[model samples]
Target: MNKSTLALAVAVGVLAQQAGAAGFIEDSKASVSSRTMYFNNDNRDGGADQKETAEGLKFDYLSGFTQGTVGFGIDAQALVGIHLDGGKGHHPYPSSFFPSDSDGSAASEWSRASANVKARFSKTEAHLGGALQPNMPILVANDSRLLPQTFEGGTISSKEIDNVTFNVGQLEHAAGRASSNSTGLAVAGGTEESNQFRYAGADWKVTKDLTLQYYHANLKDYYKQDFLGLVHVWPIGTNQSFKTDLRYFDSSSDGKNGDAGYQFNNNGGFAKTPGEVDNKTWSAMFTYTLGGNAFLLGHQRVNDDGGFVYLNQGSVVNDNRRSEEAGGASFYLFTDSMINGFVRAGENTTFGQYSYDFAALGVPGLKASAAYLYGDNIKAKNGTSPDQSEWERDLRVDYTIQQGVLKGFGTTLRHGTYRGSDTGIASQDQTRLIFNYTYSFL
Candidate 1:
């Protein structure tokens, strides 16, 4: 067993002895969530199309802290995914949506379980185990698929100060959204694993409507990244407001970053120093909200040196075989869209979105949004071909049952169309329909 697994076993054993403790048994909570998803992608090029439907069931148990100065608690999660439909030809090998069988077809089903031990002291809390899902400015756990990506790590968060919240963590391995196994961390094109990913950050709420964030992260022998973010809201009326959000990232090579088996693909775009991580990216977004309607606009620029970098284990080889199911990842950027990430070197992208809630029209649980992104001036490899460009359009609709026996049940539909010019990326159209429901048991 791995260290994290062993740790979880020991922690659970200790918790079982205290199972009858006053606070532990009284304040525990459990929940089960279900998601049914239909995913379809049509490749405009000669690539194979993917269409599949799957059902995901997730169970979570959160135990309250034991009664003491330094209280102890535990969180456990179990996930199961069942393949509802997808023929041989439609279920692609090495897919990002589901694990593959020995014959390269989609697996019938997959499941995994994880647990974490936590402690609380004053206004601070610490967690250690294999089910860490962090949502920070530097690393955002991906939950856009059937299951969420999880990490085996230890983290500490403290809100002892009045307006400042601090977070620090070190992660060793990650279980991909579609995989039943865990693997060490790596970048997009990296074949060798980096066992260490450390990060620290803080969020300061300066005023009631303003907040600032800063974070630094390093993947041992891979790359180091720093991020800065600012958000502010100006209230005009009870239901009208203007919001501004700014984000910046600076990334560079770390020890042995450009070596063989550790190369960075630069997101399949041009790189000044090939295989090396060197980048500076910034983005600005503005939003105006009135009643139930919102309008948002944003612009992002990637420096000329390289593409934006983030932790992606897609190319990692494990146990003498390629772990293709461990491929999907998310970054802290507006361009991290459903179809593509417009983060190539020298790329400048402008995007806008308009969304409205139907409550303004007497429907309280319906919403719709449409977004468009256009990117140009992407640096071509070797500076030989003309700069590439790409564009994407997305539409989404969501609704929930507000009353009756099915209250809290929700449905979402999303579609995206993408086209690019000589960028080595495929042109595709994608659509997803999802049904979500959660039940709480205490």
Candidate 2:
């Protein structure tokens, strides 16, 4: 173990020995969770077919703050991934589903552990060490595979003022879902290591149904970004309501991004200078909800300068052997569809979804939804000026035990199909079946 990991373990051990220290032991909680997943992908244009199955075991432990003006606590997680079935057909080929060996085969098993040390004072808190996962409009951790991505960072959050919250953080490294080691941050076309990522943001609740947000972030040598968002809800009656959401982002290249080894691929999309980061994006979404039914529609547009850019480890092919260690990441965007993100440069996308809950018809624990998205006016490379286009459709269903011994057992099914013009990605279909259950001990 490294210094950070060892220090976290020692801190937790010392804190656990002081079990009689008021809130520390009284509010402690533990849980064990399990997941079984089967994944299948069919490439319509004669690409490789993928089929695989995996099982995951996860354990969590959380301790409440001790009784004091400035209290201390700890949180720890253990994750284990077991490859149940993956034949030659399931080889790792440009995906993060499983760890890839020297021969491109999936590993039989992999595991990792993480911990966090936290301190609290009044309505504000500070956390340090690894296992940091932040869920904000600017950055989201991926949890779609056997394990969730984690970051090595420190963050501070304050809610001391009513209806206002503030957050700031600095991240040094990231560990992918399938790897055990941490690596420096980089984008999709750059292999240069950048260890500094700083961000600050705040949310203001101006009214009972309206909220506004702003955030600024810098990935040291890659790019800088700013985001603004607004949300409002209007009650239409006793059982109906309408919600509106608007978001905007502006991004530009940073220091090393103009140099060698620090170029961006733009996700294979069009770029004014081939490898520069220069873009602006905006989106609007509205939804109406009545009882157990919901209808949502949205539109998004990407400026003509370049494609949208976010943190991507797949571009780290020339790094310190950290390619597989930094694979999955998520960003907040309406067009982040199931199979494709649909954020190519100069692209305009329209999307909608309809969903229903079976509980409205006296059957609890079941829900279903379908969504579709279409993108047009996508810019092409080589200055061709031809407007390329693409589309995707997705369906999802979920059920959970309502009132039995397995009250929290859950099952989910999802399917998606993607097709595009000759200048875009090839056609494909994907499906996933997932089973999940959790047990708590206190």
Candidate 3:
């Protein structure tokens, strides 16, 4: 049966159950989960180098559905982070994304929380209110925190058709996980109002092994973009498989980000031009797997007179996708890099990565990956030549037990090395580790 039919059946079952119950309480569900993490980082040389140790706690709570043809629900979260230690002031890349105290220390502690109300009907869902997070490559929030970042806005998702999912949203503001205030978003290298973001998208499953996705977004007066993606996964044999993911992006200036042939008003860092800006980028990655081992290869190229990449000034796209389709998303980590290891802004760059999974080796859940990125001969139209070379190496290993005393508990280790000159800034080596566990009581 098709997925839509399946959902219809489920909905009917739920409604039938609701009709026979003491309201919707018989079908209601609620739960609270906590996540704790210990983090440490060390950066060498440069005033931007980082050396820090910290701890974080996050609480996730959900309230079951309420009565009506449109069911109502609520979800709330709270996050608290504490500074365990910071060395020589610059550790934690102090000068980059975070502001340091006169003493060069990170936030002694920081916290943020949000709540959202959701309504569901048939195969559609809508949400509104304080919880801030709506992701798009052109407007992703920086959540490298032990706690996830959020945005304030309104969004709707619909799955009324058998093979399609549609989404639309309007984001009015954002609240950084470490900060409580709502801030407008702007592109990294432009001067304009970055608030009032908007987006829409569709996902269609064409076949059991193929899926197609399309998305369009605008960051207020900053930039407008469209994304086209195709993905396929096929099994080669009992123990072998192959998968491919390809994407294309087209970008142009919007409102203030667009030059009106007028001068002196900076739209972020982008300069006013006789005409608006246009950028195009395409990338594809494929992988083949056998047993517990896998090999991947991918390449991405950007063509534009200027830095063709667009990133939210305060958020970063370091090595993953801006969309939260899954727990671990895809990123143009190599397309453009994150400033301070998280922000992105640059031009003329090409990159690739390789990874492996250990689940087939009786490890239940374990995986590792390593990546290398390089940017060279960066030239811009009205901008100076960043005639320099920058490269980075990233490594990660994670494992989670399947069935044991510590089932569901997991640990991850990550490390990175970066070196560069010119254009936007400095260089360094960094490391991060997170270990945590989750439990459910419903």
Candidate 4:
């Protein structure tokens, strides 16, 4: 245990010894999940072809705090693993959250753990700590695997007004989902550090059917970002409803935009690039629901330059690593999902989706959905004007027994197919399946 962990344990131990104070743990929720994944790829782009299978086990716990209005809480997580089948040559990305070394090979096992301390009030809460994941549009901690990614930061949230909420945070470091070691800033060119990583936002309901949101973020020497979101819901009939969502982000702020310094383009020995990049990103998605069926179509675009900036490996003090961030479009960065946490740095994108709920079909807690996305005119900085195109198809099936011998048992299966013209990374196809169970212990 590190010094911080020891300090927390001591504090909790002391509190538990008080007159009427509760034990260190006020409440606890536990879960265990399993996954079987198959990944294969035939890259005609010179990288080694990959074909492998993996199995993983994850144990998660969310703990509550001791008694009192001015309470102190600690949240900790632990992940363990065993690599079923992956070789050095045909190594699959680790079954955990992050990618292994560029070599593609992975160790037989790996794990990650994180924790945080928080304080709360009637309508406001503040947390200052490390080893936690923050998931938001502007700065999302990628958590799409057996183990979720974590970051070192502090965040504050307040709901002191009617139909309105506010959030602000500052992050200084990031730890990938599969590793226990913490790393410095990751930006465009390389890793450096400074007084950066600050963000703020607000979400408000304007009426019965409309909601408005705004967000702003900065990454020291990296690019700064601003975003606006609007949503509306309308009832088409007794069983049909229409939902509309629109969002936009601005790529002008500190760093290259906020007057911090210059961004890297070709790496000509600190000489500086010629011009600056300003981005305007927007997306509109609409979903039509009828009984157990839902159909959705959406469009998202990223203007000239690139996508928003955040932490990366080996990067500190905020820098731009446009080396692989070929852009001109903006759909991948805004997609929120249960898999593949965040997909950014692409040009124009168009997507269509359909989902079915078994509840309307006589089964409760069962649902399935599939989506397809296509992007083109991707601008690459490596002098390769290949108007490369890529497409992805995803399917998910989930079933939870409404009532029976096993009242609340559940299972989920996900399938994905991705193929593209040498889009910098190897093209491939993948499939994943998961089995989960939850029991109440109150």
| Number of clashing pairs per prediction, in order | 0, 0, 23, 22
Candidate numbers sorted by TM-score from highest down: 1, 2, 4, 3
Lowest lDDT block of 10, candidate 2: 317-326
lDDT of 2 by residue, 264-337 (tens): 88878889977789989999999999999999999999999898878776557533454754687778997887
Taking the tens digit of each residue's C-alpha lDDT, what string does model 4 give over 1-442? 5344465566546544542446335465666666555545545456665655555565666555556776666665666655566545775343233236545466557766666666667778776556656766676665455455566667888999989889998776665555555555445444344435888998899898999988888776666778888889998998899999898877653554323333532111111122233557678899999999999998877553544344444323323432111111112253543322123334577888999998997888999999988766555544345555567778889988878777777777877766666555455555555555555453
Better model by TM-score, 1 or 4? 1
Error of 2 at 381 (Å): 2.0
Q: Rate the local accuracy (lDDT) of all candidates.
A: 0.93, 0.85, 0.58, 0.60
Q: Which sections of candidate 3 miss by over 4 Å?
A: 1-45, 88-104, 135-141, 189-193, 258-277, 309-350, 380-387, 421-424
lDDT of 4: 0.60
Best by lDDT: 1
Return the TM-score for each candidate structure.
0.98, 0.95, 0.79, 0.79
Q: Which ten contiguous residues of candidate 1 have the minimum total lDDT? A: 1-10
**Number of the top-ranking candidate, with TM-score as the measure:** 1
CA-only RMSD, every prediction: 1.0, 1.9, 8.0, 5.5
lDDT of 1 by residue, 1-442 (tens): 7676787788888888887888886899999999999999999998999999999999999999998898889999999999999865998888879999999889999999998999899999999998999999889899998988999989999999999999998999999999999899999999999989999999999999999999999999999999999999999999999999999999999999999999999989899899999999999999999999999999999999999999888899999887779889999998899899999999999999999999999999999999999999999977668999999999999999999999999999999999999989899999999999999988
Determine the C-alpha RMSD for candidate 4 after optimal superposition of all C-alphas.
5.5
lDDT of candidate 2 at residue 144, scale 0 to 100: 78
Model 2 residue runs over 4 Å out of place are 1-20, 317-322
> How big is the positional error of residue 169 in model 2, measured in Å on the Cα after superposition?
0.4
lDDT of 3: 0.58
